[model samples]
Target: MERTFVKDWRGVHKAALALILRCIADHGSPPSPAELQVATAAPSAETVQHMLQEMESRGLIFRDPGSGSILAAYPLSAVPTPHRVRLADGRQVQAMCAVDALGVALVFGQDTHISSRCRHCRADIEVSVVGERIGAYSPASAVVWYTPAAVHCAVAAEGQCPYINFFCSREHVKDWKRDLSAPRGQILPLERALDRARAVFNPMKGLGGGPS
Candidate 1:
């Protein structure tokens, strides 16, 4: 893991981040600077914009390259993905990626219900979360694989990649390999997978074994 120091909260406002997240939860996406200004009443729209820019630059969130609106912040995604994290509070949010679904539960400090489809079989896979403990994955035993962030700068790009997958079992992974052009990712057990998710959400922890 390269020491890419993420100075958490330096020159950033927790309230601003919370406001953006609240917008996402309420509106299904981040508000525009104008909307954010109206919602936060943060003196001016420019101030809100500056705070957003600072957040993105600090790796606290990922913004849309074109719109500059919040695209993602860890477990939450402005754009929907197959991975969904349903909070115990009854608020559901889409995750940026497979590992991110797990990170969502960790970040909120609540039980979560993760729902996604297997990359190969397309069979529904669901996992339960109780605090830090993860329940047995549905569709039987499963393994998660991803390219470690330490090796590749973009562990997850703008869209889904074959590198991130959930195999109902190792045999299914082998079955999928036959048709692939190239192979990638390291298969991880449930516990190690959760640990990797923790490292991913905590940039200060640096890279882990895999993304999710």
Candidate 2:
């Protein structure tokens, strides 16, 4: 299948985006508009809200319709997911997918420990990412199943995040794929998956507040 990368972020507010991501990494949750206004020194809460709306429009975030609070800020998620990451700073947060879990360390420029389960068998998997390399991981045979979104898919998180997953091994990936009438993606080695994660998230580093 063809690859579909992240959208361009030219018009998105780097500072605000950075600040929001930092808040999520540091606090395990997204900041309120009032909090963001105070942190970014925006003119008012209304301005912060507008900024958030812009971020949403650009596919940088997903928000709750009822409260207008952020549910995800890409890579990091406010709601729990299969992939959980523990930062070097001792705070824990949820990643949107397997690649997002690996990208956490690169995005923050810190070490991270990931705890997740295999997509097929649900067996526990753990990985340690140090600097730009994969330090260690359980079930040495682990691999990533990557399914990029359609070229015209509107939102990254909504379009393909759910399908990008970690399996205990390539054998499990094949087993899972066999059940599908037509499997439509690639099975990536751990290192290559990390590269994809880096490509997706590394640019966000230092954009607003410089990771924590």
Candidate 3:
């Protein structure tokens, strides 16, 4: 999937998107339209809902069909996923994918502990993020599988997030790929994966007033 930097958004849009991410990081769920209206000082709930729809259209977020509650706000997912992230403040949340787990620290400007399983072997993988640097990770050979979604695809959570995953090692990545007969995805080193994540999430810091 294409990464959107903070510079690409309008001020209000940035603040709104930042607020949504902060809400998920702090409360383990996305904010309701009323909450977003109050936090963003949007004119009304209808306006907040419209903004959310715009964000969804831009692929910055995803919402439920019936209730319109946010299902995802980029990297973060309201529902549980394979990648779990524990923030510096002890709050735990789900990430949309492996790279999203790596991006959590940068987005929140806090240390993060990511717990996930290798896609192929189901081996537990633990990664520590201190500031913007990767602290320690198990199985030193751990790698990330980056599968970008098709350009015309709608709803990244369905198209791309499920495919990006952590593998215990390069060999396991190959094993899983061959067994599933999946198309080749980029095999990224942890550091390079972190770099890609930073490009996608780091710029949002300080945009929505620091999480509360």
TM-score of each: 0.76, 0.83, 0.85
The parts of candidate 2 lying over 4 Å away from their true place are: 1-12, 150-160, 181-183, 206-212
Cα RMSD (Å) between model 1 and the true structure? Answer: 7.0
The local distance difference test score of each candidate is: 0.64, 0.74, 0.75
Residue 117 of model 3, lDDT score: 91
What does candidate 3's lDDT look like per residue over 7-45, in tens digits?
333655777777787778777787777767776677667
Instruction: Give the candidate number with the greatest TM-score.
Output: 3
Candidate 2: global Cα-lDDT? Answer: 0.74
| Candidate 1 clashes between residue pairs 3 or more apart in a chain or in different chains | none
Q: How big is the RMSD of model 2?
A: 6.7
Task: Candidate 2: give the clashing pairs.
Answer: none
Residue-wise lDDT of candidate 2 within 14-79, one digit each (tens)?
A: 655666677787776787777666655666677677778888887778887888878788778877
| Candidate with the greatest lDDT versus the true structure | 3
In model 1, where is the ten-residue run with the lowest total lDDT?
203-212
